[model samples]
Target: MSEKSSDTSGRPESSPESGDGAEAAPGSTPAAVSGAARVSPGRANAAATKPARASTAPVPPQDTGPDVPKVPAYLQTQPRPDVWLGKGPQPPGLLSRLRTPSPPAIGPATLWSVFATALLSALLLGDGLGPNLLIVAVPAALGAFFAARSAGRVLRPWTAVWAVGGMALLAVPALREAGWPVFLAVVSALALGSLALHGSRSWPGVLLGSLGLFPSVAGGVRWGWRGVRDRAGDSRGRVRTVVRSAAVAAVLLIVFGTLFASADAAFADLLGRLTPDVSVGDSPWRLFLFVLGAAGALAAAYSAAAPVRWDGITVRPGKARNRAEWAVPLIVLDLLFAAFIALQLVVLLGGYDKVREETGLLPAEYARQGFWQLLWATVLTLLVIALALRWAPRGGPRDRTLVRSVLGTLCVLTLVVVASALRRMDLYVDAFGLTRLRISVAAVELWLGVVLVLIIAAGVLGARMLPRAIAASAAIGVLAFGLLSPDGLIAEQNVARYDRDKRIDIEYLESLSADAVPALDTLPEPLRSCALEHFRRDLARQDTPWYASSWGEVRARDILERTPVQNHGSDCYGLGQEADERGGDEEEHSYDPY
Candidate 1:
C-alpha cells in the first residue's frame, strides 16, 4: 500500500479510492476501516479472544448525518443501570407525579355505591344532620369495606374499630344537641378513620394521612372522571337510546296524565301531591350535597383499595448529643418540677389556710388563679421530655440510665401539676356551677394526666407503641366525652349546686341545648318552668322534618309536652326581660369564672 499524503496539520489525508490509506476489506466499507482504526489494539485482541458480554453502560447514538454537530460528552444523556435493567424510571418531581396518568378504573360495585351514597346524602343531608347522617355514613363505610375486599386488601381489626367509632361519632348529632361536641367528634372520627384505612402506624404518618384528605378527594374526582370517560365510548349508543326512550315516555306521560287528571278531580289532586316540587333554587344546594357525598365516598373507597404505605416513611433520627448536654437541662427541669410538686403537697397537706390568709382570695379564686398556669407548665414539661429523648446520648448504659432517670422524674412531677390543675377546676366548678368550657378543659387535663402516666409506663416497656397509644387515648377520650353529653352533665351539676346553695342561674340554664331538658325539668316549680320555657317555645315553633329530627330534640319535646310550663306569665325570675333588653348580652352574670 502507498503511504497517505500528509496534510498541513500533520494528519494523514484520505485517498479518493480508499480511506485511511488502506484497501477496504472484502465485505467491509471505508467507514468500518476508520472505526476499526479508532479502537485500541489491546481491546481489539481482547475482543477477538473473549465472548462479548452485554454492558450496562449507555451507548451514544451514531451520527445520523454529516450536518449534525456532535454532542459534548457532558451534554449526552446516559441511562441509569436501573433503567437499563427494565426496573423502571427514577421517581419524578411533585409536578411530574401530579401530571401522571389517572389510576385504573374502580369496580362497578364501588362506582354504584358512590352514586347511591350521593343520592342518599342529597335526600337526607339537604335538611341538615340528624339520624340521616348515620344513614349516609353507614353505606359510605360499607362501600369502603367492600372496595377494600374486592381489591384484595386485608382489613385490620383496628380498621373495623375505627369505622365503628366514626359511625358512633356521626350519630352524635342525632343523639346530642350540643354543636361543639358534635363538631369535635365528627372531625376526630374522620382523622382516626382515615389513619386506620391508610394503615398509618407512626404519629407523623397519621398526621400526613389526615392532611392528605383534600388531595385524596381531588384524586377521587379525577379517578371518577377518568373512569367515566373510558366507559363513555362503549356506552354511548346505549346511553343515547335510553335517553331517547325516557324522553318519549316523559312526553307521552305528560299528555295522557294531563288528560286523565282533567277528567277526574281526585286523580288530579293525587298527581299533584305525588309530584315533588323541584324548584331551581334548591337544586344548587342539593347538587352540592350530592357532589360532596360522592367525592367523600369515592375517596374513602380509593384510599382503602390502594392505601399508601404511610408507615414506610422513615424519619431521620436526631443527632445524638453528649450525655451531660442532654441530662443537665432535663435534670434542672426535673428539679423545678420537684419544687413545684413540693409546693402542691404543702398546700394539699394544711398550708391552704396560710395561703388563703396571705392571698386574701376565696378557695375558688385561689384555685382558679394558678390552674391555667400549671396546665401549661405540665404541657411544656411533656414537650421538654420529648425533645430530651430525641437528642439523648446513644451511648452505653450510663447514658440510657441518665435519660430515663431525668425524663421519668419530669413526667412524675408533671402528673402532680396535672392533678393540681384538675383540683383547681373542681373547686372552681363547686364555687361557680359547671359550664361547657370548664368541663371540656377538665377533660383535657385528665387526658394529659393519662398521657403522663403512659409516658412513665413507656419507660419500662419499649416506647415503640407510645405515639399510637397516645393517639388512641385521645380518640377514646373524645368519643367518651361526646357520649357522656356534657350539656346534660353541666345541667345536672348546676341543678345539684342550686339545691345545695339555693342559688341558681336560670338564664344560664336556658342557654343550654335540648340535651339538658331532662336534667333541668327536675327542678322545682317556677325554676323548672323558666328553664324549660325557651326549649318549649323552640320545640313548639319548630317543624323539623323526619329526616332532620334528632333524638335529643324528640326527647326534649316529649318532656315539654308532658309537663307544660306552669308559670308562663312569670317574668322568668325577671331575667327574661333583662335578657331581651340587653339583647342577650348577659355575659356580666355568666357562670364561667375563668
Candidate 2:
C-alpha cells in the first residue's frame, strides 16, 4: 500500500483533491456554501445546479461574468414561404408559359379589332369609308401583324388577309403624316400585342411589316431618295436613260403637236378645203389624255416585257436567263414594240383621214371606229411580243450589252409613247371628274409605270447589285410623274366633257344643228373624221360588236371600277339631264331636239 501510494503520488495529479485538490477544494467550497444557502427555500435550487457544474470542472478563463443579458426572441430569422412549394414541376423554356395543349385561336372579336383599326386609318387617309371596308383593310393589317409576329414567315390565308389590310390602312395619309418612325413603333407594339393575345401562325407577319410602305406610298422606299443619287449602275445606262427620255419627250411634243396643229392648214392647201383647229394644246383635255396614253402605253409594254411579282415586294423577271442576258429578250421586245408603234401611227393617221371625209357620224360613231384603232393597236403590240421571242436577244447564251441597251431604250421610249398617247386622248374634261376611258387609261398607265421601274431595278440587278438604289430612283420618278404631270393639272380641272356636251346639246340644240356640220368641217381632219364616224354610227344605230364590248360587257360602266366596255351608253345623258334640270330652274331655257 505504501509503495503503491508512493507510485501514484509520483504520477500526474487528476484533480485538486488528490495533489491537484486545489481545483476540487475551491469547487467543493462553493458547493458547501450553496448547500448552506439552499437550506433557505428558492436560493437552494439555484445553488444546487451551480454546484453540480462547478464540481465537474473548473471555469474557463475565457468565460465572461454570469450577469450577461438574454437575447430577445423577435430578432431571430424565420423560414421563407414558397409560392410553388407544393406544385408539380414546371416545363422548361417557353413551354412553361402555356397552361393548355392548344393556344387560343384568333376569333372574330380579335379580328374585328384589327379591321376597325385599319378602317379608321383609311378614313383618316380619306380613302372613302364604305361597306367594303373589310376588303380594303383586312389584308393589309393582317399581313402586317403576321409579318411582325413571324419575323420572316409566310402567313396562313386568314392571316394573310389581315396583314394585307392592315398594311393598306397604315399607308393612308393621316398615318404617313405621323412619320414612318412613329408609325412603325405603333405597328411593332400592336403586332406584339396581337401575337401575345391572338397567337398568329402566319409566316408573312415578317413581310407584312414591310407592307407599311406599300399603303403609305405605292413604292415603299427601299432606300431613301438620297440613296438614289449616291449609287451608280452602268454609268452608260443611266446617262443614256436620262438623255433618251428627254429627247423622246421633246421629239414627241414637237412631232405630235406640230403636225396635228398644222393639220387644218395642210388640209386647206392640199385638199382645197378649210378645217377647224387640230392643235393639241388648244384642247387641253386632248393634250392631257394623249400624254397620259403615251405614258400608259409605255408603262404597260414595259410591264409586259418584264413582269413584276409578289406585289412589288420583290421583282423576279419572267425570263429564265442571267440578268446580263435578260437584256436580250427585253431588247428584242423593244424593237418589235417600236415597229408596232410605228404601224399604229400609220393606221391612226390613215384611218383618221378616211373618217373625216365621211362626216355624217356622231361621237358614238367616232368612238365605235376608235375601237378598231384600239384593236389594231393591241394586235400590233402582240405581234411585237411574238417577234421578240423569235429574233431579238434570243437569250442563246451570249455575253452582250446591246441587249441591255436595247431594253433600256425601249423602257425610255415606252414612257414617251405613254405621255404622247395621254396628250392625244384628251382624258380629262376639266381637272376633277375624270372621263371613264381616260381614268382607266391613266390607272393602267400609272400602275404599269410602277411595275416597269420595279422590273428594271429589281429583276435586272437583283442578283448583282442591291436593289436599294434602283428602287428609290424608280419610286421618285413615279411620284414625280404622278403628282407633277399635266395629268395632275387636268385632274384638278373640275369639268366633264359629257357634262359639257349635254349642256351644249340642251342649251343650243338648234344652233348646234345648224352649225354642227360647218363646225365639224372646221375641225382638223382627224377630229372631223372622228366626229363624222360617230354621227354615222348613231344614225345607223348599229349594234356594237360583242368583242368590242368592254371588259365588263353587261356591267354598268363604272369608271371607278376601271372596266372597259363597248357601246355602253354614256353616263353623260343622265348626268346632263340632271345638270339641265338644276340649271333650268335658275334660268329659262328652251329644249330642242335636233
Best by TM-score: 1
Off by over 4 Å in 1: 1-104, 231-280, 349-360, 573-593
**What global local distance difference test value does model 2 have?**
0.36
How would you encode candidate 2's per-residue C-alpha lDDT over 1-594 as one tens digit per residue?
Answer: 677456444432233233222223454564453333112223333333343333456523422358767778897677766867755575554222321122122223323333344433332222122123333334434433432343233445533443333333333212111122223333533343232222223223233423322222211122112223333332557657766998999899667756765877764364322222244454555445334322322222121112222222332334444554545556566786677567545334534344345444332344344433443443354355334333444444353355445545665555545543443343222211333244445544554455445445543665232222333333333333322322222222322333343232322211121113323333333333333334334324523222222222112122212322233244323433554455442222223221
Q: Write the per-residue lDDT of candidate 1 for residues 377-438, one digit (tens) a residue.
A: 87887787777777889889888888888888788888888877887777678767798888
Give the Cα RMSD of candidate 1: 11.1
Q: What is the Cα-based lDDT of residue 125 in candidate 2?
A: 22
Evaluated at residue 83, the lDDT of candidate 1 is 46
Winning candidate number (lDDT): 1
Task: Evaluate residue 139 in candidate 1 and report its C-alpha lDDT on the 0 to 100 scale.
Answer: 72
TM-score of 1: 0.76
